[model samples]
Every structure is written in C-alpha cells, then in structure tokens.
Target: MSLPKELEVLQNFFVKQPNPLLGVETIQVLLFREILDFTVLRTEDTRELNTVITPLSTENDENVQRVAFLGSKQKAVESRQMERLLRTAANEADYPIEECYLKDYLCLECPRCALYGGTNASASKTTNANIKHRVAYSTAFSLAAFEQIQQTTTFNGISDLTVQTGQTLNERISVKPATIFPSIVTLHSVTWKELILMMKIILSSHKYGAESRIGGDVRNTVVGITGGWEEFITPLEFTMELNSEKEKSLSAENVTKILNKYKLLLANQKKSVILSPEQVDDMLKFISGFEIDKKFLTKAYEDVRAYRDVQENSKAKKK
Candidate 1:
C-alpha cells in the first residue's frame, strides 16, 4: 500500500541513495528549562543525598552511560507516542483494527514494537530488531555552575495540616526554572518516515524526564543531520568548552550563539541539514491523515515469522 504523502516525501529523501542500507544520521541538541522545580538525586554509598545535580564532564566514563540511558528512555517514550497516534488515526479512518493495532501481548506483530524492541511474556520471547542508537548528553554546565540560571526553593511535604504539628516535616532544595543540555542521538538502519515521526514526537512533546508531575518541558530543540559520523560535534568537547567559558559569565543568549556557531560549522564541514521545530511540526501536520501502510505491516509480519522460526529451531535443538 502507498504511504501518506508526507511519509512518502520523507522516505524518498532518506532513501535517496541506491542502497537502503545507508540511513540518515541525526544529532539533536535539546535545551530544556525546568518550568517547575524538580529534583535529580545524587547517590553515594547506597544513600541518596540532596546535593545539587550538575552536568557530567565528558572526561568521566560514566557520562556516556548516563546520556545513553536518557536518550534510550526518551526514544522509548517517543515510540509509544507515535504508536498511539497511528492507532488513533487508523481508528478514525475506519481501518480494520487488527490491520493497524497489534495486541499488547503480541508485541512482535506491531511495527513500532519491532522497531523499538519488545518482550512477549506469553511467547517467552524478546525481539531486538530495530535501529541502533548511540547517544551522549552534556549538562547545562555554564548556566548551572555559574548560577546564571534562575533557581527557587520549595519545601516538600509542607502541607498546611502537616505544618500544624510543631515538628518540621518538610525538606527544601534548590530547583532551577530552566535547564539546558546538549544531546546527540545517532540512528542506524532506520527508515526516513520512522525518523521523521520520532523527530516530531521529540520536538512536539512537552512532557519529559522523571519530573513530569511538575513539568519538564523541552523548550527549544535543534536537529542536524549528517551523511557521515565524522561531521558531528563530539558532546564531550562541546560541553568542556562551554563549561570552561563559564568563568566569562556567558549569558543564555551567548550560549545559544556558540551552539549556533557550532551547528553552522558542522553544516559547512559535511553534507548536513538542520531541521527546525517548525519544519517538524509542518511535516507531522501534513501526515496526520495518513494511516499505516501495507508495507509496514508486511515488514512486521516477516519479522514476527523470522522470530518464531528461530525460537522453534532453538526448541528443537534442545530436544
């Protein structure tokens, strides 16, 4: 079946090359400002401390793992959101539910689940058949370390009734009104349509992180795509330079300038295209009417079939 016009356009752009093996590589830098006070605990000696959360230096080995974890979690959420949108569109179009919505238990049967990976408890199977992800993040060190960003204090468990008791039962900590971080997400072997959808979810979504209760909205996001890995800026180098310049009292405006400079540099050095949030929104709007195509369903079917065959072969070998 033919895809939506918007999706078709993206697919053509992403798979322009003769070989589909070559997929688009994107580096997305997101600047997040905490709309509400939130806390990210620092653990030491198996105990949680209320120390101020700071950005991890690129030199630290743990930084990669932490950034990757954040990126992976974000991707999972974005994929789920995409699935919901698709399912709703299919329903509105009066498409067969079975053709569009895969049962939760039959995760392998769903295109989104297959791309994001899923576990089938009933079948006792897990499938990891999606694009590879390499990610790294840097703290808004310049703003945080220099205290240029506005921060406020809030007392937890400080209800009026609780305060009535003579004993103080509330704890207070500093929370920033906004936090900015630089992140790079690399996708391998993913289709253009999927990439565009993921980008839409990232840019359009307001909710993020563990602090969703208050509000961890992603305020500004910029994405740049490069044909080769060498074209992207290393997260560590970028963060370190920004942090080093903190002593200069860099304003948010100045920080953005620096980021823009780097983005331009990458564009000049490689075949790169920068996508603004507006562009992503436009694409999503254009594709809102589109439903899942037969191509996607066929791919999911093949993936499920291959997985079951492998499982059966393993069981037979055990016997």
Candidate 2:
C-alpha cells in the first residue's frame, strides 16, 4: 500500500519519530503459520522439537525395558537445547501474544496441558511455540506494545509481508495484510495512505480493538505523513465509535474540538514553527477530505499563523 502524504511528513520531517506503518497483519499471519508449521527459523540456537520427555515406567525393571538407557555421555541433545533457546528468545523479544489469539488459547504453563495427552502431542506443542515465535519474530506486533521498537526497527522498510507455513521450509509466505488496527467503520475501500496513517495511530497506541490504547496527552502529537507516507504518533483515540448517523455527526464535532485543542497546545508550546504552511494547508485538506466542517479548520489556521508570526517577530528582534 502507498503511504499517505501526511504520514510522509511525519517520516520525512520528524527526526525523532520517523517510521512507516507497514503491513503488520500480513506479517503476523506469515510468522504465525511459519512458526506453527515449524518451517521458519526463530533463533540460531534452537531447532524444531521432535519429541518431549515422556515417562515410561517408575519400576526399575519396567524402566530398563521401556526407557532403554543408552550409555550416559556428556553430549547435549541439540534439539532440546534449541527448544530451550527458542523459549528464551521469545521471552527476550517481548513477542506479542495477541495476534495469534494467544490470550484465548490455553496457556502452555497451565496445569491442564492441551498437548500433553492430545493425539497430536508433538504437533500441539509445536503449535504453541509457533504462536509465541510469531509474536516474537513479528516486527509489527512487537512494536505495538512500546512505540520505540516500531520507530527503531527496519520492519516496514523491507517488503510485502509474506510468510510460508507448512510441515516444511519451501512454502510461500501467506499473502495478507498484517495490521493491528480495529475496524470501526467499514469503507468500501481504503488507500495505502489511509492505511498507513491509521496504522501509525494504531501502532503508537497500545493495542488494536474496540477499546483503543492510543493514549497520552493529545496536545503533544500531530497526525501527518512522513517519508512520503501516511503515519501518525498522537494521543487521539481512533476507534469506530457508534457507527450510526448520530454517532457520525458527533464524531465530526469531536474532530473540531480536537483540532481546536491541538491548536491551543501548539500555541502554548511556543516551539519553532516547524510545520510548513503547506503542511498546515494539508491539515485543512484532511478535514475536508473527511467532510469535516471548515470552521475548525479556519480557527486552527488563524491560531497557527498567529504563532508563526510571533516566532518570526521574535527572531527579527533578536537579529
């Protein structure tokens, strides 16, 4: 998907929060399938688990017959060590557990292990590990929790998020969108720019769902594009509120209020007029793009311009 112009502003203009909103959902699924299928490599130190420790018999005679103790040696089981290492990697990577619906699934550590006596015991255990690995290896899901990971990693700058899944390695990465944003409103279609902007807002937030986590002092953030793509890191809670006609009207009003608040915040900061006049114009464009009222736009423009004049005058006096 093509990045939005506003998002490009954020990516190109902002030094601190530069990053594109890449397809997270596609990547999540790819990672999930690959991890579950045991085709994807998660860590160099780990290998696919073929079996687990099973108890044969407690009696010495029975144990001798069933367990067949090979002569004890100092050799480490490469597979076991790999499994252990993968666990450690997942923990360290802060792999996201949400996309795989990890929350709904039975916890691996729980008393009732689903894989313990299940017919496909080995398959079940591998499935669980794969889910964990998906969250761990996923560049998008990993960054959903803390904003810094998204900003610092090269996840989005890479390519179309595709992954292969099967009982083997030669599979193709699944073709799908990998995003954490919730679908509140159903539009016929969305542009790449729109997707990226929505993703930035979603990624900057805590999680994706009806209950949005896009929190913080909204005053400190601005929605725009960077690196010629749509992206945002703001405090506005973007969720599909009541999708009725009345709710739509209320949402429009809320947008007005938010713009006014943002304007006031800009005024208070007395920061450099970093945003160009064209960028300010784009804000108006976005408002109109959504069919929002022009009143809020006019008011915000005046306030921002006044701030710019103040900045310019201050600079002249100092000169």
Candidate 3:
C-alpha cells in the first residue's frame, strides 16, 4: 500500500535536526522494529511458557527473568546505552577521544562526553561524584509475536565416551523478526547541531537489547515532532489501538491512516514540518562538512598525558 502523504512528511522531516533558534518545544518519537529474532531481554528465573501469547509476567515471580517489556515503567533504553553507542560510532567515524583518562578525570573533550555527560572526581570511601546524563529514554515495549525455544550445546569428533562431551540443552526465548518497539527520547536545551549528531548515532544503531551475536536490526524509524504539548498520545498507545482495530493485519493503507490521524492532531494545534527524504539527505550532507574544535581536543590530550606522567613518576620515587 502507498504511504499516506502526512506520514511520509513526518518520516521525511525527522531525517534532519530541528532548528534550535526557533525555540519551539519539540519531541521526536522513534519506533525501532526488530528485523531479526533476538534474545536480549530474559527472565531471572527460568519458567515454562504458558498457553497464552503475551509478555512473560515478572510480577510476584521472583524467579522470572528481568526482561525489558512494553508498558513497563522501567526504561527499555537507558541514557548510558545511548552514550556508549554514540561513542562507538564517533570512534568508528575517526573522531576518537584522545584522552583516555586522568587522575580521576573523565575525558570530557569527546563529543559523546560533552553531549552525554562526564565526571572528574575519583571514587571515595563512601561515594563518588557522577556526571548526570542529558538525554532521557522511555521504556520500550514489544510489538511483535514471540516464541519460546530450548537452547543447547553439542560436541563432535570423539569416538570414546571418555574422549567426548555429552550434549546438553539450555533454556532461551526469542522474538520474531519484524517485531516493533516504540521508544521515545527527550532532549533538554541542546543545540540543533548536537541533536543532529545524536540522531545520526541512533539511525546508525544496528544491534541493541541483549545478544549482539544474534541480529536485531532497527528496520524502520518514524519521528513525530510536537511543540508546547507536554502530553500527547504516545506512539505506543496509538500503535496499540491501531493494532487492535487492524487485528494484526498491517497494511500500507492502515499505517498511512494512522500517521495521518496523528499529523492532523498536531497540525490542528501548532505549526509542524515533516522532512522529506531529499531534505533529510541534504541535512546529512551539511553535517558532513561541520567542523569540530581541534584546539580543545589537543589541549585536553596534553593535559591528560602530563597528569599521567606525574602520577607515574610519584609512584616510581616511592618504590
């Protein structure tokens, strides 16, 4: 089915970062659908699957595994995880942070640390000062069907029993590919450029949840922008209602209709612009040319190196 123009607009619009100068309040919600079966969230206690098809309930069951579930108050994606991913992406892009560490100091020279957070204090006997993260993530809910399976281990190429190991089975569970989960991220007082960088990291996320060995591709992303509205129907709520009405019969037309509904709701209240595909590409191109402060990084690296040398020399003198 063809995509609704409104939904298409939203999809297109999300590719670029919002303008910080406009001083408009905006929230971008992304739905990361799994493209492969993965075992990320698991229960603490091993239990057999029940007849009903639903998320494994952990309440009152101390033995149940602590898995990330939909509609749960617990965050599905934490800010720390986002920070780590961004750091990895930055390093891969050749924007490595030069200062690894100093005497109880964090390498704040890096973009990830600057955008996420960092600390300079060392651990004390009681506690340590920690840098607070800037981004906030919502709990993610599973939208696709799940299945339970038995995990196993086997050995081969041995003739004698003494020389061979016995086969064993393990307990495991998996969510099917195409399963969708809705997650929201709220940014506070960040520049448009920084937000764009964060978006790039998110869009580049390939695997998340538990097992990276098993693929868990982020298949599709749809971002919704809102201003002055602190509360709007969450993507989870909207998707749930749509799923109920569609009875799991997802189609292009139905999806488009849902997006249009949301778009209409936003348009009625405030001005909005959903980036087109071309616009998003243009933004990416612009970001490529953006330059970072090399002088700041150089100074940070030298300071960290000097501090390390002093610490090492003091230890040597004591010895």
The C-alpha lDDT values of all candidates are: 0.43, 0.24, 0.43
Runs of candidate 3 with Cα error greater than 4 angstroms are 1-24, 43-109, 118-132, 145-165, 214-220, 223-231, 246-268, 271-319
Q: What value of lDDT does candidate 2 attain over all alpha carbons? A: 0.24
Candidate 3 residue lDDT tens string, 65-86: 2124432222323334445644
Considering only N, C-alpha and C atoms within 3 Å, which residue pairs clash in candidate 1? Answer: 33-178, 33-179, 34-178
Cα error of candidate 2 at position 152, Å: 43
Displacement of residue 14 (Cα, Å) in model 2 is 2.0
Top model by TM-score, which number?
1
Which stretches in model 1 have alpha-carbon errors above 4 Å? 1-69, 96-106, 119-143, 146-166, 170-175, 229-231, 241-319
Question: Model 1 over residues 211-232: C-alpha lDDT tens digits?
Answer: 4565455543543333333334
Cα lDDT for residue 26, candidate 2:
15
Per-residue alpha-carbon lDDT of model 2 for 55-169, expressed as tens digits? Answer: 2211111111111111111011211222233343344654322111122333333111211111223323333221111111111111022221111111222334554332432
lDDT of 1: 0.43
Sort all candidates by TM-score, best to worst. Answer: 1, 3, 2
Error of 1 at 214 (Å): 2.7
- Estimated TM-score for each candidate: 0.55, 0.18, 0.54
Off by over 4 Å in 2: 1-13, 16-249, 266-319
